[model samples]
Target: MSELLDNTEAATKAVVDWLTKKAKTKSKFYIKDFYKIFPDDKPRAIKKVVNKMVETGELEFWSSGSTTMYGLKGGGIQHSSEGES
Candidate 1:
């Protein structure tokens, strides 16, 4: 059970890391971009992870008219405690 949780955490961190890197130059990205990076996961799964990240203040979302975009809460890159780059 602990292993399962660890794997989930790692996956979530990967998504966050990717978004953080992108946010450096791009002001925002669609949730679908995350789907591309993590093709193994379903959209619903990705949304769940993204929601959690937003809730934890690791990410932020914005809406431009009808389009929505997402980015890291902080402007700088955020590394996982495990030293993931």
Candidate 2:
């Protein structure tokens, strides 16, 4: 396997852009799944980028049946916490 070789800023953009595409279809994604797309970076590193994206509002996340999923802001996706019993 090649060494992880991606600039932090570029990696961040790649992740955000990928999620943006998914958002167009109102699709949800997980951090682990993202690592598969951006395999150039380590899983932990990808996680940091994802978390930062959420923190800065580039992406929005919510829990679903114990799984955390992320979607683009204004994508109209709701969380598991909403009126679930």
Candidate 3:
């Protein structure tokens, strides 16, 4: 419905703002980090918004082989798989 879309859009903007303004010094974040931003919302709902951002090209995935992270697209330390063991 239109209400659902509006809420999702608002959440998406809140996340983008947090990444750009509040957590500006950090490049990557964990899913748990977003819990602090939307304490009233269910974790599943938050994940939905974040994953949507990834699908929309607003964020990108970062991995260190063992762990996965999220960061603003083109705004964090570049990851290269060229020289790895």
Candidates in order have lDDT scores of 0.69, 0.69, 0.78
TM-score of each: 0.69, 0.69, 0.79
Candidate with the larger TM-score of 2 and 3: 3
Residue range 1-85, candidate 1, lDDT tens digits = 2232237678677876776676658756788887876676668877777778789887777766898777777443332222554
**Cα lDDT tens digits for candidate 2, 2-85:** 233246567666776777766666667777879776766677777777788788887788785789887666465364446777
Best by lDDT: 3
**All candidates: CA RMSD (Å):** 9.0, 3.9, 3.6
User: 2 or 3, which is superior by lDDT?
Assistant: 3
Instruction: Give the least accurate 10-residue stretch of model 3, judged by summed lDDT.
Output: 76-85
- Local error of candidate 2 at 17, Å? 2.0
State the weakest 10-residue window (summed lDDT) of model 1: 74-83
Q: TM-score winner among the candidates?
A: 3
Q: Write the per-residue lDDT of candidate 3 for residues 3-31, one digit (tens) a residue.
A: 43349777787888889885568878988
Question: What does candidate 3 score in Cα RMSD to the true structure?
Answer: 3.6
Between 1 and 3, whose TM-score is larger?
3
Pairs of residues clashing in candidate 2 = none
